[model samples]
Target chain A: MSRRARAGVESRIDAPAGDGAPGGSGPGWPPWACRLAGVAIVVHLSALLAGVMGVAPASPLERAAMEWFGPYHAFFDLGYSYRFYIEPPPTPVAVATLHFDDGRPDETVRLPAREIRGPRMRHQRELALAHSLFVDARQAKEQTGDISQSRLARSYADRICQIRPGCEMVVWRVVQHLIPDRDQVRDALDSPGAGRFDLFDDSLFATPEWIGDFPCHGR
Target chain B: MPRPLIEIRRYLAELSVSTRAGWNRFFFAPADPTALGLIRAAVGLLAFWSLLVMGLDLDAYLGSGGWESAELAWSSLRPFAWSFWFLVGDAWLRPAWIGCLVVLLFFTLGIFSRTTSVLSWMIVVSTVRRAPAALFGFDQIVSMLLLYLAATGASGQAFALDRYWRRWREAKRTIRAIPARYRKDGLGRAVEPDTPGLPAATVSANLALRLIQIHLVMIYAIAGLAKLQGVSWWNGEAVWRMMATGEFVMFDFTPLARWPMALSALTHGSLALELVYPALIWPRLTRPIMLTGVACLHVGIAVVNPGLSEFALVMIAANLAFVPGLYVRRLAIAHEQPAVRVLFDGACPRCRGWMALLTAADPCHVLAAVDLTAVDVRTVHPALTEAGCLKAMHAVTASGRVTAGFDALRAILLRLPLFWPVALLGYFPGVAWAGRIGYNRYAASRPRDVPCTDSVCGIHSRTSPPAARDRSRSHAPNNATAIQEDS
Candidate 1:
């Protein structure tokens, strides 16, 4: 055989670290490259596929990575990049009201969703938590006919106190008909009078300590 | 009547082989070292800059009493228990930050390329995790780039001080190995020449570049698909919404109300380019165009949108992989080293075609071609006469060595590291005989239109007069072409 052909056979036999089988990456290509690339392609594609197949394997990992890394998860995981925004039809808007009993200015602290801070993912986490708390409060009102004694109401009221010092009363409420008319201009979407208060179920949370002789405490 | 089933089976086998060959080429082709070197330096600098930026408010960011207190940082982590900050106390924060910076500096310099690359990537992840609230586009991309960079070896190919240090080591070793030879500097003491080693291209670098390329595709594909689901992207209100948002508004785009179409196109065009990127970037012909378009897209985003912040810059930096290593090598090395201008018969389509690929594939664009078909080859080359042009393919090196035929091919291949092995094989007697026979065959198989094409011109065929025209010598030049494929 020609020397060139002989060297080819030798290179194949040796199969050095950078040199794979014949016709592997070019003669100069790293030997470990093809397999590494293959593994990566297979793993990344499988993650993407599982993400598509309703996340049998990837979903758990995706959720874990998200909780761990938040916005940084996209660096480690592969699913959330293509996730679309499908929020439940806006329920008036979930708002948290903080009522101070030590009597300061009448302050209504809107749910954390409205006040976005830092990265979008952080804001997203805040919204998701607020929505969960809002849902739990509604379920409690449906069950007990009152939100003041609800566990979520008390815990959430405590958090509000932590977030804002010396706060006494906190109430969570939803204004019905939050999505504006199709024909309405963009500027009108956030207008104060755009939606009506669901007075009967609007009060989602309040401080449990001061049920007061105050008439508005339960309402 | 042909055997249809048997023929179909044969065709499928051929197709399978062809595809396998292509797959091998894609995954294993000896990657250009210059390209990897370029990517390494670029990625390293970005890492250095990023890591340095991370330390700007390190004490405040990771300190016990700053914006993110230790308690808040730990609680924010929840069940995911991983962080550099959690392990290190407040007193060690500055020291840790400094250590991270030193490692990043070494990484960027390619001192201990892969080791420092991994260390830097770890630091990036640790720092990012410590302050999730502070994370943005730049932080995410830097981490991703570092992860990919860690997978490859010898990212510091060209323009790295590591090359100088490596050569100094190699030179010292050579001086020691050669006890009899007196090597010295101007002081006349034994020493190695300061010339650095040729950009040491490696397979690892190729694989790394490919990985980055693949990862970029996935990012674009996912991002494009996600945008497709958004109502604003479809309604053309996406740009308007972006403009209206206080968080994203960089340049004053309020005038977009009057030129709504321009605003809509800007938003929609970005999505359109991203959707097409993964699909079109695979084909070689479209690869450059797609890479260029995406690069511009990022530049536009950086200029007009700027919301992704470091995301745009990091992506543009990553896209450097597609810039073609041969071209980069040509830019970096062609000036520092000797180059040869080639003289070829441009009338030969096969020759011109190979020349085009060689030119395109050449990492160092040092090969200047002067077509003998149109002009007097001597006028441009100065050394070569018309007889030399007819003798074989020739090139005049910068030192003005007029090389011809297989030797000429060897000289060109010598300059390209990928083709150096092919050139070395030509030195073997058996290979040399086969190659000469092959070159003569192609040279003899003229299209039969040239003036005085026979007689002395076809001296190799003079042994077996004209009727058969050296049928046995036919595949020789093909081997020669194969030899130069690395170039």
Candidate 2:
């Protein structure tokens, strides 16, 4: 194409020549279209604000706004609460012990197994799965029932039974790994270089809370 | 009209006009799609990697017999959320997974970008929806980015095969019409030719980038505000707490316990940076500081929390939203081929015209052209003689290897987006031999340069063709003398 024609095309696409918020005039959509788009943008921004605000520990007003904008968030799959490290809780992990139907030794499996060799992203997925088991436990506690009876746990146990064909039964529990305070770490370690206190010390863990036990059958 | 009533009417009119103009500038003002294209390419690759990893445990994660049964996972999505995996049987699982991977690969490569980007997003959403139990912050950020990229529909305008294909087609047509143009006008009227700068800009590109920027600000604001509710964040123990968490920790952070003050600083600094980012990021002055702070915070998290490394990478990628398109375009170009220097005979108008075409074709800015006539050719490389450079083009590659003649042209074409197809063809068996012979003949056929002592030579020198003038001007002062000489 000729340079002038190309330059004309480019100039047509140039941003408005001005500063922020008050005025910036350029060739653009007609007034009505701009107004229509402005309204849509306002609504979408409001929905985004409400979606974040509606995360738990929210006030009644935020909750109501979220409810109003629920469909928008749901459709876009934008249910991000953005609550990174908020009220950080003790780490919860599921430990599964498999007993084989054959004359094989029992094997222990962690849902987010440290031995789950691969990319950290894959490990992160396993961690999320482990978290679901913990979520199941938390929900069970809220409802004052056995975690084994929860649908998540049942489905999880069933899947475990189906996959490890040799396994006759599967038993799993949720354990919370508590973070020791500064004082506790200082007291436990003999010196800065001492091996006395490791971050993974077994003493920092809560007792394992049983989630479920299931016998493997060809479902 | 009364004075007060007239004043009120004027005020209202001004407000209305300003508001309309501001709205158009913010959302509808056109921007180069380079930044959005960068994001699309990155997010597409991330999505591809993410889906590929899921394939490792496809049966265990998305299969009907997987960790969470399809029935249960599908049922939980309820009325609003949907996934193609919900309907796929065990038999179709691998095929569906492979298809999504193929689409994502194309999206990453910018092949049929507009359609593939949407498909890539759909595939991402479907996969995430189906395997919700496997989600983390990575999923959230990836989804958000994909939404904006797909919405823009112009993400393929820069650094994409879609763009390359379009330009390639234009070049093909232009080449085909050249003979006809020559037939029409002896040498054809030498009008100004197109040279590369930024890609075409559009309102959709602006809107997409704006949406991503706003969304990222909201994320930071929300995350920061949410952290304020916790005692750990207030006391500067949150970072330590996260470090000590078993599932996420890559290395034991117990030694960090001794450096509580440093921990506190990190904790407080992260919180403060997040809190201020939404406000500070809009200003040009504070944007770099905020982006640096963000990189540090996320990279720190990634180092300590390996499981959340993907999340950290996603957050860093999202922050690119705040970066200007010009910088992103330059960065993308610089990354493609940073160390190739082309030595050309600047005195030759034909050579200068060829250089003009090359510079226009090279969106990546891969070649750094050094004029053979302007400098001591030996200074560029001990091996480079002025006579050798004048005879054929020479290119010094990143590895310090020198290529000449057809090989040099082929090397240059490999880096230019439009010439990749032709360049690839030169690599086929005996094609290089034929190409080298053809290049030698063409070089030999060019008229030799001679000093202007007659009206014919003077006219030819003065004409200097439009492309030669433009190309020579982009070089050193000596090139002006080169432009005055006849060929």
Candidate 3:
């Protein structure tokens, strides 16, 4: 036989100790060690099988525990508005007209021709009168030309544009006689701008006397 | 009819020898010792890397927010709790970076390999336990294997600082033992006495190897049985399910899945194979078939599974058990020598008895004995005198040198299966002196005419010598005398 083949035969005949004939004792282990090893192997295999089957309770418990220890509400997605401007139109000089609208407390007013700095002009009479009446009755005495209703609306729109670039204006006609610098007009402007905007649908606006009761008036 | 039986016996002997030789050549013939060394180096590097990684954030893997954070049913004993404390004290409590430095030293040096293994295992286990949410089977297998290596004392062998230290100690001992006369010699003497060598540690090593082989077989048998016992595995659907899972879906099992019914049948057959593997190892006819099936199964597992390379390697090692012994001896002779010729008696009863004893002693060593009276000794060895053959046992060494009597026995012992232990005994101080005295005593006790029945003398007596038998009987001491001598 070839040398290689002959050597293979020798190794087989001289099989390593413990690797004796079949049914013979294996290595250093006795029957008991084999039994113990067998049991351990079985248990480990069972556990592995259970894990593979997703039947292991440890998996779920582990996930729950992880979630509990991790940061709370750390990964969820909140959606409020920034008020930009407020404007009051200048007074119109036709019949010294006074227009009262529904207004509430904390209402801000802007005048196109004047700059009222801080509290010096806080709650000023002219701005308040212009905001409440839409046309200032005191301005009629100082006017040298007739002021049409269309001209009053145009002046309001122009003042809104100067103070707040994107502001819109709507005009409302009232049956009451025009009043100049009245306390009622001051009260109407000082209340708040809850339902004072005439651009809103009629159902959305409240009467001037009822403006103080509107929910939107609170700060 | 008698001739055929003799032929059968001869064929069986030859077959046994050939098979063993084939296996030995296949395994050890091309072995690159360097490959084993490289494997050791790789493992060491891996250990060092793991140690470095563990040191970077030891605390992150410990305490309430760490591995201990996860509450496992089996974690109540809290085996890793001590390991965590060690890490914490070493890393956070100690001044500077002593903890990592110490771990790195242990890993690199492989000192206290078992302890390092235990510590590393605990840390890895604790980490895995803590982050059971992670899906890394490779890490788990690596950790477990590392733990096994540590527990099993694999580091005792190679590529460790331990081995280097042992070698250094051995070298120092050798140097110390050198004779002063030899050391002081101005020039090498034309003829110098043979230097005695250190005792071979082969026997103890072989013992350890045997234990490992046994353990390896147990693992295989148990693993096979376990797989066979599972209903899902028996039905083959377990494999299918494993393949179907997202984590295991890397393999394209679509084609196999298409024929689940056929695949399930194949699985059942596999289960049967595994369950019967232990039984198959015994029967000569079935051994080859079973071994082939096992090899294929392991190969299939390797292909279909991740982190099964170690398992495959171990299984292949275990398969070496199937080899026989006579063939191994023949290969050892062919590669290292021509053939071992043993001269023995055919008619002498005592000679036959000794032959049986030697046969059992050196199961792996190739041997052939011829009756000195029946054959011409010169054909095999032209130098062997008939008078020398008749006087004592003789063996020719691998170098074509003749050794006789006790020396011949020692040489034969060296070549035997698992004979390293006995062979190593020959290297002890004054062992040769003792052996020479023993052989002399034994040779002196031999009967001149007839082989004695008692243990005191004679190897064999001629079969048809009635007068010699009568003389032997008369020479035999009475029962009373024998008893008195024993006393």
Residue B56 lDDT in candidate 2 = 89
Highest TM-score: which candidate?
2
lDDT of 1 by residue, B1-487 (tens): 4799889999999889766665655556565555556666666676666656556656545665443456655665534345677788878988988888888888777778768888877887777667654555566667767877775654765545566466555545543333244222111112333342344445566666776776677778766776776777887666565544332334654444556577668778878888899877765567678878888877765555454545666788787766655465544455644387777654343454445434433433457666554455667667777556755678788887887777788777776554657889998879877887787577655331122343433433323234332431332233223222422
Candidate no. 2 TM-score? 0.78
Worst lDDT window (10 residues) for model 2 chain B?
Answer: B183-192
Q: Could you say which candidate leads in lDDT?
A: 2
The candidate that wins on DockQ is 2
Instruction: List model 2 lDDT by residue over B72-124, tens digit each.
Output: 88778745777878889999999999999999999988899889988988888
Tens-digit per-residue lDDT, B1-487, candidate 3: 6999999999999888765554332222211111122222344444444434444534323333332232221243232222244334323533423453465356445566556655555545444444332213223333434444444444333234454444444433432332232222111110111221111212222332333333334444544554644556754565554433222123555345446676677666656666677566545567679778888877766565433443444454345435332232344434553246676433233444455444433322355555554456676577886557655667765567777777776777667533557767987889977987787566544443333354433333323267866654454324312322442
The digit string of per-residue lDDT tens for model 2 on A127-197 reads: 88888878977787679766677667777878878767888988888888788887677656745566845
C-alpha lDDT of residue B423 in model 1: 82
Better of 2 and 3 by TM-score: 2
Q: Score the docking of each candidate (DockQ).
A: 0.06, 0.31, 0.01
Candidate 3 chain B weakest lDDT stretch, 10 residues: B190-199
Better of 1 and 2 by TM-score: 2
- Candidate 2 regions with alpha-carbon error over 4 angstroms: A1-27, A30-32, A101-105, B1-17, B179-197, B332-361, B364-393, B396-487
- Which candidate order results from sorting by DockQ in descending order? 2, 1, 3
User: First chain TM-score in every candidate?
Assistant: 0.43, 0.78, 0.20
